[model samples]
Target: MLPSTSILFLCFLCCLSPIVPTSLNLTLPHQHPDPEAVVEKLQWKLNVSLSRRQMLGNDGKGTSSGSPSSFSCLTGNPIDDCWRCDPNWASNRQRLADCGIGFGHAAMGGKGGQIYIVTDSSDPDPANPKPGTLRFAVIQEQPLWIIFSGDMMIKLRYELIVNSYKTIDGRGANVHVTGGGCITLQYVSNVIIHNIHVHHCYPAGNTNIRSSPTHLGWRTKSDGDGISIFGARNIWIDHCSLSYCTDGLIDAIMGSTAITISNSHFSHHNEVMLLGHSDGYVLDEGMQVTIAFNRFGEKLVQRMPRCRRGYIHVVNNDFTYWEMYAIGGSANPTINSQGNRYIAPADVYAKEVTKRVDTDEKDWTNWNWRTEGDILVNGAFFVPSGEGLGVLYAKASSVEPKSAGLIQQLTLNAGVFGDPRDSVSVGFSGGTTTSGSSTSNNGGGDYFGMIFGGSAAPPPPSLTITTALLSLLVIIILNSRHPLLYYIHPLLKHST
Candidate 1:
């Protein structure tokens, strides 16, 4: 055995390790928030938002078609209309905390924290990040409202590991996270990612990375997912553009729940979004996600959220193209799809929007999958299965869904709407190709090119995967006999 001093030092560092779940912002596992109560709260918020929307479409029929009155900046998408239209949004960014309206509505990210401005756009040192860099901002122990100083593209050399109670707000700048491992929220909670572009993310790992100011641990190879949520809760991703990744654009698994993915754009990829891991991950049974007010656009193949055992709400979105099925699942998940537009491709065999992977008809017959007021065009269809789940949906779908006719208007500003200078596209997969009509039938360019272009600043990439997956897991094994190096910090230089 080592000396007493050496043993104490090892224990201290172990507590500071990112993998240890030592965060203070969340309650202990024994004192975990009640899942049923969380669902009830989400139901209340959605019902409240629905009650406020005078969803009198032009024809006064919500079941058929119509839209909100023309005299307002609001688009009937409760989340976007809450803050995107405000002229003073940049000044009162924190007010956005009150605008959340779904399972993640309780995620008050960085609301009580001080604002942290990221003025540096440099590639970060995974072990010793410099102050003012985006890496430094996210690794802090305290809550922080992080925003960019100007328009810039950040290509991270490592996977970005975000801490709890933080908000990465990219409202006014042309921010992009590309070229390396993208955002990873692991064993943390209460994070808000808004108004940025996340695409062309590649896998990165096999290095020592920092989490808190005092912790630096070895990392593993990451899946190139744009936003990877692993064992986290209370996450909100809104108003971002995502495309062209080696893996799923946004993947949440390993018991990650209470998530809201809204007002975003996804395109030019194979597997689009994944909500659960392999079908055998029983821990994911508690996962609950809200996919709302987004546009699943051109060149997407499948997995507009391939789910597993969990409760999923797919509401108020637009599905334009999918080479394969749009939504798929296994291991008995409750899917509540309401008030969305699905435009199937010309492929006759792919017209059906749902697929239950490997599960037989008899077994999946009782899984609660239903669609309410969804507009299926171009012969597209959703074959829903299952039996009575009124109680589950009552809390999930209390929000009277908006009309599908208003999808274009609601998702028109889905991505980074800006000028030519405000965006960038780089991917190993085929990208920059428009899958559907570029022009809108409504005279305004809101379709493929229909997606209005705009400029805002961006963040960078970071590594991701289970337990950090294949990479970080190896580190954990090695750390038993040989701990990570903390003394490497003095050699790394940074701003005062």
Candidate 2:
């Protein structure tokens, strides 16, 4: 095996290599929907997600189980509080689709599709992918709730072009797409990628790759992003762990919008996330993204989403560590930061969380960048620009803001792991039982009987009466014949 330094050097060389595409395949898909309508719908979803909490009040830490080491079933956050803690999550996986919040709430990825199990881990061919492989599962036309038969590491020879209406669900098993080309969602819609690990991706392309059953196109070199969203909308990436890629860990550029990245962990990289393609690219002005309930942890540098022209809502995330700066942008993006815990580094000069890249103060001072209800520590401070602004910043305020004090509870389970005992620690404190006791996983959700290292298979949550009620509310709204916003507004109408 090569050293980590040697591996990084090779990845760098691969990224710099020039590989051009010779064939143009026009049948895949492309979309540039109007951001005005998309943001209005997103704004509505955020309001509905908030409506339930008002109905339930400010309680999150539910009555504890009698066990000495037990986690409260409800975590006080709207998304997770929607019965993800129900021990039956493994059997009723489709229910997870209705719990989305923020901009990507409407992305119902493969909710009604067949459950396709990936039994093979090898990607022997990029163009003619075999059945039972993950590559084949994602490129299919029909909606699919894709799952892994067991723990597998799928390395690709080229970027995995995810088709629309697909959900890559990695709940009961450990799924990894690493050590080569990673995922690319270009001009697609309604896609969800959850609970997977994507890392150590080097540039892989410059060859023929298949996107669907009959279409294969020449692909140029990729940026090796863990997940690259290009001209795609209505996408959600949740509870995934991303790190150490050749380029940005997650880059949504070239007119992507209506996206939410929540409950995920990011670390050990430079230029962590890029929200826009370029300053001169006018199409990216339509981008709207929500970064919520995520944990940005150790060994990470700047660009925890460096923005361009767009509307970005940064809500209730835990920034326990960062060098240089945490949030950055250029091209007069409207940034609304609310209820995040920002702990700056020891360096005095790097305390500010916001960076208006390359632009002079005269131009950036007029930008609508404001931090509300944020908790800054260790000499950390946020420079609020264009305060008292209502219209543009309100577009970014689609998501409701929780108190930063609740960040520890909101983001405790940011990343994915099969067993709690084996989960990687982000070095931030949270209330959890490492004993792995009191959490039961019985019946057919055995997870191949291998995930828990021969112990009990620990799911995300255990059940409670409150969580059951919460789940019922979500089910009612999702199943209602009327539009979602109409149902939620009346429910929250009587409340303040």
Candidate 1 Cα misplacement greater than 4 A, ranges: 1-71, 388-403, 417-496
Worst 10-residue stretch by lDDT in candidate 2?
447-456
Among these predictions, the greatest TM-score belongs to 1
Per-model CA lDDT versus the true structure: 0.69, 0.69
Top-scoring candidate (lDDT): 2
Tens-place lDDT digits, model 2, residues 1-496: 3246544754564464444222211111222233334434444544454454443444443234312112344555566656466778888888888988777877899999999999999999988999999999999999999999999888877789899999999988899898556998887899999999998999876788899897887776777889989868899999899989999999998668888899899988988999988775555666778898888887889999899977787777878778899999998776767557677787998988889899999977667775654666666767766532332233433344343345676777887844231223332232111111121222311111000111111111222333333333433343342244234433211100
lDDT of residue 84 for candidate 2: 69
Q: What is the lDDT of residue 253 in candidate 2?
A: 81
Residue 122 C-alpha lDDT in model 1: 91
